[model samples]
Target chain A: SAVISQKPSRDICQRGTSLTIQCQVDSQVTMMFWYRQQPGQSLTLIATANQGSEATYESGFVIDKFPISRPNLTFSTLTVSNMSPEDSSIYLCSVVLPKSGQGGLGGYTFGSGTRLTVV
Target chain B: GIQVEQSPPDLILQEGANSTLRCNFSDSVNNLQWFHQNPWGQLINLFYIPSGTKQNGRLSATTVATERYSLLYISSSQTTDSGVYFCAVLINAGNNRKLIWGLGTSLAVNP
Candidate 1:
């Protein structure tokens, strides 16, 4: 079980601006996931970042709008570009850990999440 | 793509009541999980019950993988249990593993 420290737990940004959210995991992991939870909506995966490779974005999401940087196994950053009021939502970072007693299997752990407010 | 459906979009109960939440998926999954999103928007993993049953304290979950469904039971609920409960199922796509999430069931417990 790894603990992820996510910075700037919350922020209020002006429209047309940009914001970069960072997640630092205490342990090394192969893949880090970025998700967006819009107001009163279920979580949506934005992209998956693996060290030394380009991030793979989900359908309806683009790399230019949500750029992801996975510089190392223990760190990653997600930047929301050209923000708008419709972008107001909570952003979360997640990593998978070896499931207890399951041997090779794993479970998901998430960062505390960043609450972004766009005006 | 996988589809997940959770029953009872919302629930309200007394502090000591008991309840059950159900999740149905359209396909076989590699794994299934239950999560609780607190008031502050912190997503907490409640269980990793891909099959069979597992219990932690007053919360228990069962995932009948063969039947493509899962159940979460909350006994003697507390106000602290009030939040959004979600069921997500993981599916393998080529070399990648992705989680398909349900809309979630919003719960409110009052004193």
Candidate 2:
């Protein structure tokens, strides 16, 4: 299992302002992903951050709106650029654990999440 | 893209009662995971059962990969177990492990 942590557990920001959330893992991970959960909704994948490369975003998401940066294997950041009321959601970071090559398969560990409230 | 469907979108159970949640996938998937969102809005992973069955204390999960379905069993539910349960799956191939999430099952355990 991997231990994940995120900065700014909860923040209240005004509309049109941007906030950068940081995710740090206890150990190195191959892939880091950003997700969003709307009010009373399930999680939706935003992008996959790869170290030394550009992030791959999912449909309905773009780099301009949500810029991601992965400077190393254990750290990444997600910036909600040009925020709006619609962008007020819980953002979480997750990492895939490495397999032990035995009967056990790898799982995902998610951060505590950064809850952003846009007013 | 894979479609995930969870049954009984809302459930209210008494503490100490048992409950079962189900997840159905549209296509073959290489990965299946269950997550619980607490009232504080933290997504806590429950299990990663792509196949077979595994139990952890009062929680157990079973995934029939070939049938494209999974089941999560909660025995002797507690007030702390009241939250939303989500099931996600990775479909197509292994190139991208992008998870498609279900709307989730909201379980409320009343004392």
Chain A TM-score per model, please list them: 0.94, 0.94
* Model 2 root mean square deviation, Cα atoms: 1.6
Model 1 iRMS: 2.0
Which residue pairs clash within candidate 1? none
Least well predicted 10-residue stretch by lDDT in candidate 2 chain B: B90-99
**Candidate with best lDDT:** 1
lDDT of 1 at A113: 98
DockQ scores of all models, one per candidate: 0.68, 0.70
lDDT of 1 at B96: 98
Q: What is the lDDT of residue A73 in candidate 2?
A: 98
State the lDDT of candidate 2 residue by residue for A38-114, as single tens digits.
99888988999999999989889999999999999999999999888999999999998866566454678799999
lDDT of each: 0.94, 0.91
In candidate 1, what are the lDDT values of residues A32-117, reduced to their tens digit?
99999999999999999999999999999998999999999999999999999999999999999887564333589899999999
Task: Give the TM-score, chain B only, in order for the candidates.
Answer: 0.98, 0.95
